[model samples]
Every structure is written in C-alpha cells, then in structure tokens.
Target: MTTVSILPISDANGERIYRAIAPDKQSTGRTAGEALDALTAQLEGDEFNALLLI
Candidate 1:
C-alpha cells in the first residue's frame, strides 16, 4: 500500500496551497480538494495497489 499526504503550504502571494506527496509522485493545486483529485487521477493506473490519501 502506498500513502499520499496532502500538505498545506503557502504560495508566493501568501495564499493557501496544497501539495500531494508520494513515491515518484507530486502535485500542487490551489486547494486541497483539487490536489487530491489530481493525485487520484495520476494514480489511476495502479488499480491493484492500495492507496491512502491524507
């Protein structure tokens, strides 16, 4: 099983940002939900593996 963590970070303009982190995978977005959606799509190919999104 692989787990991805969504970290809340700050952007250059001091706005809220979200980043997803996993093995060989990374994604950034304006919101946490958006980041999660992007990460999910990226991991779609691993159909048999378990993924934990945090």
Candidate 2:
C-alpha cells in the first residue's frame, strides 16, 4: 500500500499551505483540502490504498 504524510505550513505571505510527502514525491497546495487533492491526484488519481494526514 502507498503511504503519504500531510504537513501544514505557511508561506511568506502567511497563506495556508499544505504539503504532501511520499517516497520520492512531494506536493503542495494553498489550502489543506487543495493539498490533499493535489497529492492524491499525483499519487494515484483517487485510487490510493491509504492516506495519512498530520
């Protein structure tokens, strides 16, 4: 199964940033939801085995 980790962060402008971490892969978004969407899309188009948000 593929495992991913989510991390919340802020940019220089203080905008909400969401980061997704996976083996040899990473994705970012302006919001938590967006980040998850992006990360999932990158991982396997919503067919991921599992997702872990932190």
Best by lDDT: 1
Cα lDDT tens digits for candidate 1, 1-54:
667788999999999899987787878999887887787788866641645555
What is the lDDT for 39 in model 1? 75
- The alpha-carbon lDDT assigned to residue 27 of candidate 1 equals 86
Report lDDT (CA) for all predictions: 0.78, 0.76
Total clashing pairs for each candidate: 0, 0
Worst 10 residues of 1 by lDDT: 45-54
Q: Which tens-of-lDDT digit does each residue in 1-54 have in candidate 2?
A: 667788888878987788988776788987767776787777755558765757
**Model 2 C-alpha RMSD to native:** 2.3
* Each prediction's TM-score versus the true structure: 0.74, 0.69
Q: What lDDT is obtained when candidate 2 is compared to the true structure?
A: 0.76
Predict model 1's lDDT versus the native.
0.78
